[model samples]
Target: MFKRVIWIGGGVVIGVVIAAKAEAYVRANTPKSAREFVLGTDQDHVAERTLSSLWGQFRTIMDSREEELNRRYIDRARSARH
Candidate 1:
């Protein structure tokens, strides 16, 4: 079970890297289409910007939020322990 979990997780990481590289490639080759879509130019633009970019953006946003929540949680936990 543990091995399978690692295998699946590794596969997911590999897929994300390939997709991000692909997205960066497409953005380089097709900036007008890829770049324009990031804005509110078209509804489909929301879907066109590869999952990796979206995930990368979300991961960045969430990491900050997670750190904040962790700090608060630790502060509360430490206070309660006293």
Candidate 2:
């Protein structure tokens, strides 16, 4: 029984030490942006860039569609005028 208790205690201590080391390593290796996020800093630049890129893509698509519609309208108007 004593041997079993010793083994269990040793295992628990080892596990705790390993977990602490891993936590430290992660905190050390984390990027500034991610660390700022963990500290509750306002890191909206990433979100803003993503939203801006998506909006740009959407505007490009809409502009192409608008140009196609305008070309079609102009063709119809010219034909009717003739």
Candidate 3:
């Protein structure tokens, strides 16, 4: 059971990575208008961007939020200790 679970989890990770790489390749090679048509997005600006770009932006926002949350938690902990 444990080995089966590990195999399934590994397969899922590999599949997701392959899919992401394929998507990045398509996003890079496809024309802007074609990509926009496929994505059905009204924004003309994002037509040229790849998943990596969007992921970077998302990661930045998440990191900032995490830092803010950590700061708040530390402050609360210190207050409680006093």
Against the reference, the lDDT scores of all candidates come to 0.75, 0.77, 0.78
Better of 2 and 3 by TM-score: 2
Count residue pairs with overlapping backbones in model 2.
0
Query: Can you write out model 1's per-residue Cα lDDT over 1-82, one digit (the tens) per residue?
Result: 9999999999999987886676566667765865665544553454465556889999999999999999999999999999
lDDT of 1 at 82: 100
**Model 3 spans > 4 angstroms off:** 42-82
Question: Candidate 3, which ten residues in sequence have the lowest lDDT sum?
Answer: 39-48
**Tens digits of per-residue lDDT for model 2, 1-82:** 9999999999989986885675566568889877676633644354465568889999999999999999999999999999
Candidate 3 residue pairs in backbone clash: none
Candidate 2's C-alpha runs over 4 A off are: 1-44
Model 2 CA RMSD to the hidden true structure, in angstroms: 18.7
Best by lDDT: 3
Q: Write the per-residue lDDT of candidate 3 for residues 1-82, one digit (tens) a residue.
A: 9999999999989987896676677679899888667655644444256556878999999999999999999999999999
lDDT over C-alpha atoms for residue 49 of model 3? 62
The true-structure Cα RMSD of candidate 3 reads 7.0
Worst 10 residues of 1 by lDDT: 38-47
Candidate 2's TM-score = 0.46
lDDT of 2: 0.77
TM-score of every candidate: 0.41, 0.46, 0.45
